[model samples]
Target: MVISPQEEPSPLLREDDRETAVQRLQEAYADERVSHEEMEERLDQVLTAKTHSELASALASLPGENPDTTSTIAAAGGRIHRGGTWRVPRILKVESAYGRVDLDLSRAVIEHPAVDIELQLGTGGAKITVPRDAIVEVEGLHTGWKDLRYKPPRRARSGGPRIRISGAMGFGRLKIRHARR
Candidate 1:
């Protein structure tokens, strides 16, 4: 009744798996268990992981992640700002209704090389700041009578994080800019 490794079904790496690995790396970075360069390298591996084994290897040296991890911010008729040394989750979901949401990743600690941001903006604005070397990709954003402006990255460079933003912005503007540094 035992299944061989080849006969067993291989676990496909999913977005959630990548997120969990990144979260573990973030915690390790916070606990000083991994240096900045090591964190970045591990994050890259996590994002580009193709199989469950690869994903597991990314966080194998780190502590286990919380099974019930949540990294979502909802702003209803108010302002929500995330900046300054905050840990960037692997998949950050922001929901705003008649409010503003600002995310500054200039000095923030990013755990994933490819971060996915799910935004639901309504009659509100969002300003996101990332490092100059990072890559910003916006998708699935449809605005009505409003503007979503941002200087797209020239090209994806090696060893730089890629921010994949996907959401709907209604009558709200979303601006992505590079850090002043």
Candidate 2:
């Protein structure tokens, strides 16, 4: 839904919300949807806005992240880990043949309402830590040796992150968990 000009952001808006807005602005700028000057101006507004309408105003005119954009991280062997604060891509593919993969999304800037993660692993196992409210699905995943180590919530609330995981792996266990409150 579009955020109208007069609509105010919640006073309880978290830093994560602001960071998501900023990430979207940067994505739009990178795609040439906005000129450099517009990017700079909106970035200033986003950085200064705190429980203020400026944040909404700055983001009101920007388009959402490109739906077709996909990013990949590949490791021939060793380890691959993503944590801390990072932008969550609409689609992400991770591949590793002989090492562990640990991805922690508890503190990520997830601009999109849904995200897809495709994994290809071997021997070393994997662990994915998602936001507490994320709704996760692994219907299309195939594991060679062990069953995936994820248990979905009985019921998920509306309007949280939707994560779809699909891929194939051999000789490793895949584990998923939501971040603790």
Candidate 3:
């Protein structure tokens, strides 16, 4: 049976679905399937998409996503940096020993309503950058000889991701900051 556009199933797209679509669009743009202007336009639509059909339309002609993946990064006496238009995993574990880590999630495509970040900091420091609209909560944070510093979100956003960061820092600093627009 052929379904008309109006008759198509248009379930509401969850925040996670929208994020995934945005990530796919970004990948398409990077692969040159879509132009810069088209990517920006699709991204805007994805951010404001209200229904599954709308989100699907935004990612139309794009490549399919791979299976869900998790990432773990360990730094030993070196610097670990993750930035650019990468996909944010549902769970991320970072371990640093006498090294530094920088995780920038401003342009990341977050596929979950809540992202879990586990950090193991030792004589090293970490800097986490997130979107200004995201809600960030650092729990069970213990720092010795340093501090975990971040300005509490002024107000929680309805459809933004929540970053739950929990970890220990010894002789190191953990700073959570908003991304510069």
Best by lDDT: 2
Give the RMSD in angstroms, all C-alphas superposed, for model 1.
13.3
Candidate 3, residues 1-181, lDDT tens digits: the string is: 1112343333454465665667678678888878898889889988887765566567654544442565788867799887644567788888888888899886555667888899888887889998766788888778888878898767654556888998788888888987644
Question: Residue 137's C-alpha lDDT in candidate 1?
Answer: 83
Candidate 3 accuracy as lDDT: 0.73
Task: Output the better candidate (1/3) by lDDT.
Answer: 3
By lDDT rank, best first, the candidates go: 2, 3, 1
Error of 2 at 28 (Å): 13
For model 1, how does the per-residue alpha-carbon lDDT over 47-137 read when each residue is reduced to its tens digit? 8877655555566545444323447898678898875334577888899888888888764555677778888888788899886567888
Q: lDDT per model, in order?
A: 0.71, 0.77, 0.73
Give the TM-score of each candidate: 0.61, 0.65, 0.62
Clashing pairs in 3: none
**Cα lDDT tens digits for candidate 2, 86-120:** 56789999999899999988656567888999998
Which residue runs of candidate 3 sit more than 4 Å off their true CA positions? 1-69
| Model 3 lDDT-worst window of ten | 1-10
